[model samples]
Target chain A: MRTTLCDRLGIEYPVFGFTPSEHVAAAISRAGGLGVLGCVRFNDPEELDRVLDWMDDNTGGRPYGVDVVMPAAVPAEGSAGDLGELIPAEHRAFVERTLAELGVPELPDGAAERGGVLGWLHSVARSHVDVALNHRIALIANALGSPPVDVIERAHAHDVPVAALAGRVDHAMRHVDNGVDLVVSQGYEAGGHTGEIASMVLLPEIVDAVGERAPVLAAGGIGSGRQAAAALALGASGVWMGSFWLATEEYRRGMAEASAMQDALVAARSADTVRTRIYTGKPARLLRTRWTEAWSAPDAPAPLPMPLQNLLVAEAHQRISAAGDPSVVSMPVGQIVGRMDRVRPVADIMGELVADFASTVDRLGTLR
Target chain B: MRTTLCDRLGIEYPVFGFTPSEHVAAAISRAGGLGVLGCVRFNDPEELDRVLDWMDDNTGGRPYGVDVVMPAAVPAEGSAGDLGELIPAEHRAFVERTLAELGVPELPDGAAERGGVLGWLHSVARSHVDVALNHRIALIANALGSPPVDVIERAHAHDVPVAALAGRVDHAMRHVDNGVDLVVSQGYEAGGHTGEIASMVLLPEIVDAVGERAPVLAAGGIGSGRQAAAALALGASGVWMGSFWLATEEYRRGMAEASAMQDALVAARSADTVRTRIYTGKPARLLRTRWTEAWSAPDAPAPLPMPLQNLLVAEAHQRISAAGDPSVVSMPVGQIVGRMDRVRPVADIMGELVADFASTVDRLGTLR
Candidate 1:
């Protein structure tokens, strides 16, 4: 079952699991695929280092990687060139006003003093990347676009694969041109930042585009072996699993929150989900909770771009996270959430995937 | 533009367009709410005649009604049912061979030619209420679910309304219920059959589910102002034309294939399109050219379910359509093709819709 990507990543299956928790990452890796720790939410270098070390000690030398969110470019004409400084009082006012209307109370005084940094953004992402590369990371996958030349060079120096997630083929080609070894074609069905295309179509199109030039892994809306077999048929070397993991027993997260996510899964309809900047500063697919609802309202303020959106909602997210209010929190899950029926073990998922793949291949052979 | 659908169909904008020709239905009502069409593809004769004729002429002096392909209900309890008799031996052989290769084909030439039985399916559709009656034909709508009892009775009793089309909530929920006046939510981007989603999110979720509820007027991708605005903001009491009409000064079996529909505006993104079947017996968005080279491949089978997977190749749709060449025939035209650049007239479509019903009202007030 060692596919091209599995061989390259030194894993049994070419499954790449993305998660913020190191435990989940390590679990996926130990289960015979690569687990790329989502470094986007890691607040600081020191914290990431601890988590990486924790993963290292737990995995017993299993290979893993780090995932970042870096775009190839933003409005070069700079409509938002000065993204941070452009945070006018008006935009902040909009956020403030929206929170109030949505019944979101003011941030508890001294909330920041209690725990982590108030938010996660580009800068935080870059710093975390630096931290991961400094560690024994074997690969660096950017969630959005091409990694900077320096990051590409640095990873190459360490002999680590540098990969990028792309919503479009042009973006993947750009990453490949910039020396990216792999590209995860994250269609709209994936957990976070995505393009409008579904994985069913995007995977094959991208696979065709990156043939030999770069190995493309299918992401978004992938959960079962049928979907994976579909992806492979479309030409993806592997699958990047997200929503499925959230349903895994090995996944570490607020149990209640995961339960709420379960509720979301059952009620999951395409219309029930939306692309919004309720989380981070980009267009991401999230559960349509009150938090996202308020943002989507007619009177709601125009959401801040990328990091600003992340900053504005961080505290509210933290509040909801602590309060355990699913409605008020941004639950980032993909359309594939519909297929996640129960919380199972990671190894169990891998086993099912392998069996399904073999069976699908056999079934497909009969057709031929 | 204060055309009350109720006034038009002697009912209200709550009309339905259920004709296989989405653009035609969209155009009628967009000029101030007409009958809905685009249903028969489902092939259910729940109320075939009453639904079809009612859908064709119902919109109370306004256009209404839809037709869907409800062809598969015959195989009840795992039985091929009556449709088996419809399948000629040669056609049956093709299916056996095709299934031997994949699932089913959309427009099997032999099956199409073998269709005295399938045409009888149309007769099944034509059997609604005995006549168009007091229910003025405002709009017609159609889908696969057994035709609602009231759809036939109400449209007849009301003196107007009708609708049809397929594949999603946006298209599925015809303004409130089966009682919709007229609507058609097909997603063919440009043409031929259609797919599972996208007529711009299935015409504003079927114009909040059926047009008459609020005169929901949207097409697969109508391409003009009157098209974009009326349906989107100003109120579709105006237009919804498809890409087919874009080059047709006069409609002749759907305008001939256009050269490269890749202009930036229309290139929206491949994701914007969906592939489904309501035309033949499959589900395939219209993105290919030349018998789609794809359909000719070895591993190109195992399509999804009824009216969907078969739509994948639409049964070598071109084989019979390309001057009967079995190579270049593409069918069905949705609103998405408006991005095709060259303009003809329908009156002048090759056009386009959306909704923010109240805002358009507010904009009108401002203009005043």
Candidate 2:
């Protein structure tokens, strides 16, 4: 299952696993794939630095990466406290009322006060890049397309390749023009913020559009080795998977206290998610729950744009998580959630993917 | 490049082409694939019979199929005039106003009035089946899952197989239990009426669910041979393509007067379509134009349920097509429209698909 991506990234398999948990990322790296730690959950730079230090010690000398979220045009820099004032009261009230109606209690006193909007701000994302480059990170990825030109140059200067997620050909071309080394063509069926193009079309489109400029990694709707083979068949250099890892044993171990999210994910079908702007103030695929359904009501206030929307719901999300109710939790997942019916160790999942890819390829060979 | 579907259908390749034009259907059959002619456009049973006769004569003894639309539960039978009175006045006015705003002129005097809702009704669909069975049709497909049990029995009596389009595992399972011989796993990215799951996920899911009961034909987001290869990798027996054929030379020749639709399609990108209910009262993907965008406005009337909505806008559709303006033409297309950049002969498209599929398989074998 090796491609040029494996040679370029020095990984045994051409698989890139994106996760918010440092433990899962390290496990993926140890399992012969690139483990990309998502940095958007870190409000403080020091927390990310601590996680990277742990990752460096735990990866067993394997290569891993870090992902940061930054909008194309930098928004006005503001602290989490200052950004709280920008959220409309109506939107805030709707969130608060919905949470209370769902019976989600407030977080316990002094529970680390997470869910701040600072992590989404440009300033914090830049700080993430700075901290990631300081560590032995093999790659740096920007979720919302190419980072600023200086950021790309800084990564290149540090001898680390920079990858950007694009949902359209124009975006992929623009990322390459901005000096990105790779393009992760994320599709509409993916978790988190996504564009309207599905991976089946978006991948080949971006691969053809960014021909010879940057390697394209297929993302979204990929859960197994057969899907990975399909990605290569569509002209991708490798496969980038995020949702499939949420059901991994490492993920369950890393977030042991939050079993509700795992329970919800395990019980979900492909049709159980909805695409809405209620998450992160941008269109993202999220598990369809009572919380998301409330926002769909006719009178519900329109979700604010990114950072503000995330700020408004961050506390609500915390409460929903704290409530320990799987039916009302707010989480981002792709359509591949249907196949994540059970938990498996990261190593087992990687082994199964490789074996499946091999057998699928062999089966396809017979047709030829 | 053949699966069990090829042996069962007695076709050379496992490609099932869904098209409305008899000329295109005949070309696909003669070119070695099964061309399923869409019959919903024929409100008159005799018109469909005539087309089947034409297909029988042109297909050169090759196999072809017919597609009909009959909802799960039959609606009350009504004449086109009787159904016309059931459409709300405001809905009628909105369509008229939008047509006028778009400068779509009314049809010329003495032109045949075709956009009747009868084709969508159960009686008309049943008549289509009766008429198709009287011809040399090789298959009968229901766009909205399995047709009536009697319809399935009727097709079997003639030694013709029945195929159904399914979007979910449950739907596919039900189709098999209802005696369907093949299940077309149509995904969210498909043209016309579709389910929310994308083909990348839906294909494997349906294959797993249907097991050995029925062969699944992967549909949606498939335009080229590489995609067809991906479908086979995902466990599908064949590929069912609808939108890719819209750019074929046979289609252009058949609908020569409507070059505007072809022009709009050629200029479109994968992102040029929007999934909405304005077109058919049920959600369907259509080319994003002023017509669809107008319905998205805050004050636009909620699209009436199927049959009613189609009745309300049938004349508007006639006017829009009559006006010969590509900018406002309403057409059903999949995300694959981006790849339909030029018109080519049907045989050429079929040849490329076979060659592409073989090459893709050979390329995948190298990875193994």
Candidate 3:
């Protein structure tokens, strides 16, 4: 499924997979698709550097990208240590109360806090971009909004294309105005931070608005070959998938937490997901576990803003994960989780996606 | 441009246009698409009969359908006259106060009381079905949910196909289980009543769930040939559009109120719409006009449930329409309204759709 985007990115197909696992990223690149490693989990720059180094060594010289959360607007301004002060005592109390009520056990000693407010701060994301650039990364994608102009220019200087995720047409226009190389039009059904617009509506709008300026990647609820074909038909240069890879063997092999999350995901349907700001201040689609439901209670405290919310829930998430309770473990997923009933290898998934896309195209070709 | 759905319904194109105007419906049928006349506006059975007769006379042997709003769950249970008593006086006062604040003049004498709560009740909708069955209607579609088992059986007894609108996979499965011949998977992007799931995610899920049992018609955000092609590629049998025709010449010709609405729609962008429960107590996507904004104000009262909300706002809507105040007129529209930049003939729109679909398919065929 070659397109202009595929040729420009030096990939055989325009299927871009976003995951946090270096194994999944390398596997996707080796299978002829672009696997973008999400850098939000790498709180330590050295760890990020190690991950990128590992990717370079394992990708067999194929190209891959790095994704970082650098939202245009930062809710708080402080160092990682000072950021904790921004979280209100009420939010902390609420999180503690909810976790206790859910029977979630505390994390063991030295389990490591999973996602503190530090990772979401601009300073950390900038560090991630710097580490990513030190490697042979071909693309840099901002998960929240358009990357800062300086960051875009820096990526450009390094001959790396900068892509940004947009949930609306105006967002896509802003990215184009900032000279973004590509825009990932994510729909409300996407796993992470997303806007209210659906992919079907958002994709064509972004494509029409910025197709001349940059190629658009369709994201949200795209897990299969037919959906990828539909995305391309909707004028997207490629399909940017995240949740589809959550069920891959590579993903499970990299993260021990995947066992509980994958078990919940396998049994979950489309309706089992909800868009909640309980995780972060920004609304993100995640599996509707007890952790999410506790926050959704009628009397639950309103989530704190951005970095504060992330801080308030960081310890609770760590505790729940360490407890290995599938019911309370919150996992970022899309409606496509309904289709992920079993685990498969990245190569098999890629083979099926390409084959399905070709067959769907052939079917449409017979439509006249 | 043709499919089994078109052949089964004896139409030239698989496009199904849902409109409240007989003129627009007939024009769509004459233009080789099935125009389903929305029967919710017909408060009286005799009026619906008259409109169907008008459609039969104007369609020139072309196929057409009828759409009725028969929700699966009726929030209010009572006759039309008695249901008015169920509407709280506070809601009535809010509607009146909002209308006065917007400077919407009172309805002129003999304004015909356009839509009483009577039209929305289950009994009224069933009567609409009875009236529609007598006409040469090619299909009967439930707007709010899957039609009752008896309704489906009744339509089947007459050898007529029964279709229903679904916003999720389970809804589509329920419709298929109830023997619906077709399911219109209405996404969140569509105008009127819609579920929270976006079309991109919802369509493919419904298609995969019930594609073998019944053909799925994709609804929501489909205003052009490219979207239609994408829907077809996603496994939808056909494209069902409602908002796209709102800007058509025939629509304006049928309703004098379309002038201001068309102007507002033309100037509106994708974000200039909101899903609100103020109109019918059901969350429906409408152009973000002053009317919707007034209800969204912090001090505004919570909208009553279903028939109560419809009853309270019915007179207000009539007064606003008669006053021709563009700002206060709440028009049901989808994100696709952004694409409706001009008033054109149905035939011209159909031509563009067919041409765009062919070119889109050709473009996809070359993606290798």
Highest TM-score model number: 2
Candidate 3: deviation at residue A281, Å? 1.0
Q: lDDT per residue, candidate 2, B148-170, as tens digits? A: 99999989999999999998999
Q: Is the docking of candidate 1 incorrect, acceptable, medium or high quality?
A: incorrect
- Please provide, for model 3 over B1-368, each residue's C-alpha lDDT reduced to its tens digit, 9 standing for 90 to 100: 77788778898889999998888899999999999999888778998998898888999899899999888986566765687887777777888888888899887777677546576778889999999899888999999888889999999988899999999888888888889899999988999998887777788889888857889999998988889998998888899999988888898775878788888888888888999998888899999999899999997999888887887888887787777766776889998887888989988998899899999999999994
Please, what are the lDDT tens digits per residue for candidate 3 over residues A1-368? Answer: 88998779899999999998999999999999999999988888999999899999999899999999998986566865687777778878888888889998777777766547476888899999999989999999999988899999999999999999999988889999998999999988899788888787788889988857899999998988888888998999999999989898998775787788778888888888899887888899999898888888898988888887777787887787777777987888998888888889999999999999999999998885
lDDT of 1 by residue, A1-368 (tens): 34667667777788888886677788888888888888766556797888888877877687999888666664212222354455677766776776666666666676562232322444556677778877777789887788788879988988899888988767878888899999899876567787766554456557767889988888876766655654565456778887678767666452444555555555565445677776766788887777777777787677766556665555566656655444665678776655566678888988888776666454433222
Q: Which parts of model 3 are misplaced by more than 4 Å?
A: A114-117, B74-77
Interface RMSD of 2: 0.9
In terms of lDDT, the best-performing candidate is 2
Query: Which residue pairs clash within candidate 3?
Result: none
> What tens-digit string does per-residue lDDT give for candidate 2 at A167-251?
8889999999999999999988898888888888888889889999889999999998889888888988899999999887888
RMSD of each: 20.1, 1.2, 1.6
Model 2 bad stretches (over 4 Å): none
